[model samples]
Target chain A: MTDRKKTTIVLLSGDYDKVMAAYIIANGAAAYDHEVTIFHTFWGLNALRKDENIQVEKGFLEKMFAKMMPRGVDKMGISKMNFAGIGPKLIKSVMKKHNALPLPQLIEMAQEQDVKLIACTMTMDLLGLQKEELLDNIEYAGVAAYLAEAEDGNVNLFI
Target chain B: MTDRKKTTIVLLSGDYDKVMAAYIIANGAAAYDHEVTIFHTFWGLNALRKDENIQVEKGFLEKMFAKMMPRGVDKMGISKMNFAGIGPKLIKSVMKKHNALPLPQLIEMAQEQDVKLIACTMTMDLLGLQKEELLDNIEYAGVAAYLAEAEDGNVNLFI
Candidate 1:
């Protein structure tokens, strides 16, 4: 059998820094030719939000969730020092100065690198997020799917 | 060579849930006979604080850090839904109901299980955290020490 490694990350936190770390690791591992899969769930779904609103019908709670949550990676708040949303902007400028890609660009890069992006269907249902709300070209799956991929994986992380 | 594995966790976030997560993973990995080392730094040092004040001489910034930061894990505020510090208390009560160990207890259990606890010396210098401010029977090290342990670690987590 060929010697290959698989890296699976369960991106559970929606925080800006954590999501950035997840993508960075995923892309870095993929660059090493490791088979990579990122399972985004719960708050992590916010990372996949489209910038423009999609006119999808939802219940009151779901509507509230969608409206209250940040629209996309560019709008995400820092977990700390988020003084009325200014911290994220400051970090964005710092990222720019360091020539680090923004979260959107990082996500795009991970996708381009053939890193599998799977959204937890259960989380989407619970959060009232429709497929139209997320970015295109991503697959939807459940925990069983993730477990199958991670069972013999050399590296598994829960972010 | 033995089949034993090493797991190194970098505790960077001082948020209540996040710190709890770090310990939970450490304890769980220890249960599976994996060697675990937790590197605590920056705000993460808040988790290592003793609830009672320790009469130790320190510089002005050190004293200020000791006074301003949370005294211990029990005093840490949640990263989100803090709601004026109610969220952590709520979670603590839930943990009690579920017969789950509190963060302090988890720390103790980790120590008892021989999990290595390393406080980041550079962060201590930066944050003005003196050795006396932390728990006893722990190691003090820098990133090089962590790297030495993590170089061959099958699991390396940055929390």
Candidate 2:
């Protein structure tokens, strides 16, 4: 292993605000020259989904989950004060007013900064998400990979 | 400074399942002889609350927060499938059937193992949670203290 510090994050929540926080920290760590990795698992996988529907074969439960979950960051709701979808809109407007980047842009910034983003293959199977459903240029791995990175990480987080 | 590996967890979600996961990991790390600290913040503070109500003076918003949030681990809902509070009960029953310890008991075990439990004072102020409202023997700190612990932590997680 190199001498550079490593920061590993396990993104487990599907909420917009939580995902944004994860990306912000990842970008900050990358800017500091840390080797950063974000492992998306469970509901967090929703954040990496492509905005458009992907016509892929799936079982009934898988189809139901795909239909129930949000497609991408823009469609996600805030963890708190999500008053029937109004909270996300309100926060986006507030973010614009304050000249802050939205969640999608923050995610793009993480990619631009070369933060290694991985989708948990186990959860993808459980949730019925195929590789075609997720964004391009992201890797797929299981928990063992996450543990390998986290064990040596200077900053490891499950967000 | 010691040779023992350190695990620092930022408990940010009040969901019963999430809190249980944090405590489970903390307890496991402590059992493995790692120094563990759980920094409770935001909704996570609710996990440290005493089950009984404590009469304390508070502003309107704080009072409203106290009234709305769950009093303790037992009262907290699961992050997913919380069908109007039935989820907690169902999980509790399942835990009992499997002979697994409940959240409160898991917390007790953590304390028994000497895991450092810290309540975020800033969040306490924002949520209007006084010391009297929380459990005894736990320390109160802010983000700076959390950062100090986390920066040196071998396994730092924000759960």
Candidate 3:
């Protein structure tokens, strides 16, 4: 295995389905022995939020931003046909029926598989999300960090 | 050139940003000499619509469906902060200043690079979009067709 391949995924959407797809791809790539890195930016940062409120010192706008967006994968809405937020519930039910892991579980699985998770520092600053607001064990980086990794990656995707 | 790889993308979002990412990846993959196939399903089918009205014989539902959705890539709204459809235009100006191609032009580049475009028949049926409502030179296919192609693909994405 001298020639280990790399997969870099830029998760730019915070929608449940899109985030799920990112983890699915990352997990699959990891399963095949490829190093996978997911860069979470902008709306994608929603997937990394902690479900429980972690009182972190922030400005009023940051507090409002965190309050308004979904806390975590479980709370994110579908990209379309959200239908007053029932759409995510419906999709979860379907996933359960199919014995597929929900978004939260998928993220955990990717973590267990040693997939590198990088949260975008620029987005966090813009959205006013503090480190305490996000889940643990994730790296914080800028676009240059992602581009550096993607430069040598055999597979790179922006979603 | 012997072990040429393949990339398959399942485009399921019609949002301007998402659709742009899809075409960008498709074009990048094609430029690398990989055989790329994009399966446009559900909302993704919206991206393939012709900007001009196509005279196609269809049922009332199909006519209504066509009328409701954005005509083509040029008209798609951003997934968030659309602000009554101004977000896409703002993004377009940014793209132009960056010397980046607009979504429509990106789609055209992918096509010229010989990327395979597949419209999901099941989605078309469900959405009541007739074949005539879409652009020309695209293959209409069901899930099985996509699966067959993806089976041998090295990179598979759902966006």
Predicted structure with the largest TM-score when compared to the true one: 1
* DockQ-best of 2 and 3: 2
Q: Is candidate 2 or 3 superior in lDDT?
A: 2
DockQ of 1: 0.09
- What TM-scores result for chain A when each predicted structure is judged separately against the true chain A? 0.96, 0.98, 0.96
Q: How far off is residue A72 in model 3, in Å?
A: 12
RMSD of each candidate?
6.1, 5.7, 6.6
How far in Å is the alpha carbon of B153 misplaced in model 3?
Answer: 0.6
How much is A53 displaced in model 3, in angstroms? 19
Q: In candidate 1, what are the lDDT values of residues B31-84, reduced to their tens digit?
A: 777788999998898888888887877898877877888989988987655778
Give TM per candidate: 0.65, 0.64, 0.64
Show model 2 residue runs off by greater than 4 Å: A1-4, A10-76, A85-152
Q: Please give the range of 10 consecutive residues that has the lowest summed lDDT in model 1 chain B.
A: B90-99
For model 3, the docking class works out as incorrect
Q: For candidate 3, lDDT tens digit of each residue in A1-159?
A: 248899999898888888998899999999999989999976899999999988788765456556667889888888889998899999999999999999888899998999999998756775678898888999999766665566557787878
lDDT of 2 by residue, A32-118 (tens): 778889999999999999999899999999999899999999999978657789667755764564466788888888999899999
